[model samples]
Target: MTKPQIVWLRRDLRIEDQAALRAAAEAGPVIPVFVLDDETPGERRLGSASRWWLHGSLQELGDALNARGSRLILRRGSAAQVVSLLADEVGAGAIHTIRHYEPWWVKAEQDIAKRVDLVLHDGNYLLPPGCVVTGAGTPYRIFTPFYRAAMAHMPPPAPTSAPHFHAPARWPASDRLDDWKLRPTRPDWATGFVEVWTPGEAGATERLKDFLDVAAEYETTRNLPSQEGSSRLSPHLHWGEISPATVWHALDGRQGKGSESFRSELFWRDFAQNVITQFPDYPDRSFRPEFEKFRWRDPAKDENAKADLKAWRQGRTGYPIVDAGMRQLWRTGWMHNRVRMIAASFLIKHLLIDWRSGERWFWDTLVDADYGNNATNWQWVSGSGVDAALFTRIMAPLTQSAKFDAAEYIREWVPELADLTDEDIHDPPNRPRGYPDQLIGHREARERALSGYRAMKAS
Candidate 1:
């Protein structure tokens, strides 16, 4: 019998720079498999936008693999059962995949390993979570210490090149990629995603190359929502089409503030993963126990609160910067990091809505919605995280917009404001005819948020 190993492609979707694929090919003949399991528990499922993105990404991966004389086998249902069946079908002795830290994924990997030789690789993160810690050997709650600790770890391995002469034992029957119907069927809301993105590993490489060409200017330009200074690799990274290691290696030779700043972003991702690894339920609940009793404002029961949330979501909050950020996310599946901070702060602090609602909305909508980053970012903005800002520190989106000169971004996303002066754009002089009025006055909202925060801390 020819010794064979299975390469389980999860989010790390690219052929070139794939650590698990390289490892499996070196072992013996390799079989590549992708399983779609919809029954994952204690975690939310992929939203419509994510489903649409996955469809295109998988199609691209299939084409890439076919070009390399291999095929991707697709199975749907229970992950452990599918892997076990494929192992028998291919007569494979081992399974190799990039390790993932999501709670649901951790369980599935454990179950599969009990029945077979499951070799896991750290391909998703720049540094393995829990690898970095204080001298006392405990995880750091604050990002500064956590980020410093993560950087102290040996840098991630250089990205692996595509493997050679590795062919599958046989082409196992794959469910037609189209049959998954991962894309939208009716009321197609993905025209923006289609126009904004090119999904897959091939696109991932192009984006990285483009960003590197202009990296010297990135630190200054990345904050502009309308600017193209961003790497735009989040979807790729989210899908595992590009590894963090690939990004780290590409910038290794550069010695500038730009390189240092970009590296911090990667470290932040590592910091987030470390937090989630320590507290698996971090996304749905608070990391700090006292927040469990935090009296979050209830939008569902209160008419004013419900209207406030509606205004925020619909881009009619009467705060130009906040409206622009929300509109940007609505029109595109992504948002600028700075805008994300502004909108989240407005929602959690100004509207006094619960952060979870904002988080769920982003989780449903963002192409780069990683559990750790999404959860921690929301908590950070809402003053609910371990080292969060003081709740009394209210962020007025109008002030933020002026500070950042976000008129261009606002104009692009909300054309109704295109004619307004920059000063007037940040805070409207009057309610525009097509747009709604302020649902909650900014100063009043700030006071409510501060009072609520005080009540929580008092507990």
Candidate 2:
């Protein structure tokens, strides 16, 4: 009997197109393990929304494995320590896992390698991060050139089907899924999430199939919040329930601006990973150094700033579009991409809050929250990233609301404004009875943001 090969699971939860699982199954008896190593990520541990998704996803994966004459071993501790102990218990030969680039995961991988024959494979991204590079042989910092270069390697290799698992003679003890308490119970804020999302590989496949029908119209309808124009596959992709290659190949040969645009968004995911690979601390710090000196209201020190931050989080910021987006995020664990920008801008520029504060909020709230993507987006909106918009270009939420025709979306999320006319919904000529007034006048906020930018430059 060949020694059992341990396949360590992380974000790559699905069996299909999972290189590590495939390799392990082929090698010998496979023992698949998922360690709930909260200590590894420290402050970056899975958030409440993410924890809810994980419970469902893990249950689905465990059942799938059981159906295939195997089981998903659940343990809680440091991943390196758990895997080492498990390997010893099962007399496993080698540990297999997909490569991950998060700073903490990278450190965990290195630590695990020291204790076992750890084999890593790449299947998470369309192409591995550092594989695409400039003529100078260094990674490209900008997106446009990187996208052009990466296009040459378009359509990643066909994804492999789930491999047959040869079971071991004896199984190890495992923890019950219910015992983990991953889902919220006190007040149960995630009731809406259960209605909006399905958090498994099957759910991911269904979402892709649904997106294919509208993929051709993506470019035109994507920005309109009222329309289901976006794919809504972020959480699935972030969890690696569906591989990027699977999505790319699914849309292969489809002709339309929408298909092209959607594919570009996928590439952007790859681009974000490449960024964090080069800059591990990208999440907590500004990519542009001078912006560090820029004055931002500290909620801890200022009561007014604290109150404003509280209102923003509660979706009472008074700008219908911004409030709607934040509320949508609270209810659904996700937000429309266009509105995400508007809401983020309102916080960073309008409230004069540090972008990090908003980033941390999204990190805790979003089911699809990814360290690289979250930080990159917030920094981009704050004009503090390497490839960021000018700090002077503060977004006017009212203008954006009307321009994007978000009246219907606002109505759905902000019911107080539901009775308002299409003409009055976006700006709400008079404050609705229940809705709060605008946090700050758009013009006043814009000028203040610009003045702050100028001061930063002068300093």
Candidate 3:
């Protein structure tokens, strides 16, 4: 009688091209499990938007496992304890799982290693974090050098085929997914999400194929928020529904500026993981220690700051592009990358609010709210991370809107500006009715931000 091999699922939810899942199945009869371990990362636990995506992704995973004459064993508890208990119950010979970079996950893996023969494989990234580094054996602090070094490692491993598991004589006990309450019910703000995204391996595959067809134009059209120029694979990738290796291989040998540009963006994603792996506290703190001295406004202490934050969140900031991006994020659990920068800059620089505040909001709202990417990008916008944007380089939202030609995007999300002319969409000659007034003049805000940065330097 063959002993069961347990495949402990975390973010790597898919079967195809899954390193750990394939390795587990090849060992003997495979028993797959997903543990909802909220205890590992208390405050960093899955936010409402991520929970919504997880609910659907897990359902799809369960269905796929069932068709293969196996079913996913769902359990809720501390992962270290639950996985250890499961391994004992099944008398498993080995446990296989992909490497995860999240600080909590790092801890859980450490805890789980004591009980079973844990086999960690790489799947979540094109190359696992810490694999690429400077010639001096240190992780690259800047993206350009990192990108150059990472690309040389080139084209991740050729994806492996999905495995066919041999089932044990009897299946182990499992929990009902619905009992976990991963989705919301009181007010379904996620209703628009279903229309915009399909969170599963199959859906991700389809999206990848669709994007590849138009990928040749990605370089020119990606910045235009109204166009479907992007792969829209961030959520899928975040959940590991599709492995980065698969994406790399799919676009392999494809030639176009868009393909190259998209691949570079993937490099950026890898860069974020590299950053957070070395700096575990990257999510809540600045990478550059000097940024600790920077003066940032607090909504908790000032009424005006509080109101500015509220307007930014509610999409009434009176900046067309920024407001549209916020509203898009609210309605669909996603936002355009270009507008993400604009909106983040407005909050951090224009409003003088702490980038952490905007980071927390995005953490709660984005379906693809990855801690590494979220933290690294937020810090980049706020000029607080390594090789970050300079503090004085405050982006003018109005100029960015016109440069990117986001007028159509604004019209779609900020309907009050629907009647404005294309030329005036970015900056209306007069404030439209029902639209809130600009919270602060651009020049005044710029000067104030500069003054704050200077004060930090002097101090």
Error of 3 at 345 (Å): 0.6
Candidate 2 segments whose C-alpha is farther than 4 A from its true place: none
Q: Cα miss at 84, model 2 (Å)?
A: 1.3
Model 3 Cα lDDT, one tens digit per residue, 269-302: 8899998888989978887787788878889999
- State residue 266's C-alpha deviation in candidate 1, in Å: 0.8
lDDT of 3 at 422: 94
How far is 345's C-alpha from truth in model 2 (Å)? 0.6
Native RMSD of candidate 1 (Å): 1.6
Q: Write the per-residue lDDT of candidate 1 for residues 264-307, one digit (tens) a residue.
A: 88777777888788888877887667777877768878988887
Supply the global lDDT for candidate 1.
0.82
The count of backbone overlaps in candidate 3 is 0
Q: Please give the range of 10 consecutive residues that has the lowest summed lDDT in model 2.
A: 386-395
Cα RMSDs, all models? 1.6, 0.8, 1.0
TM-score-better candidate, 1 vs 2:
2
Model 3 TM-score (2 dp): 0.98
Provide the TM-score for each candidate, comma-separated.
Answer: 0.96, 0.99, 0.98
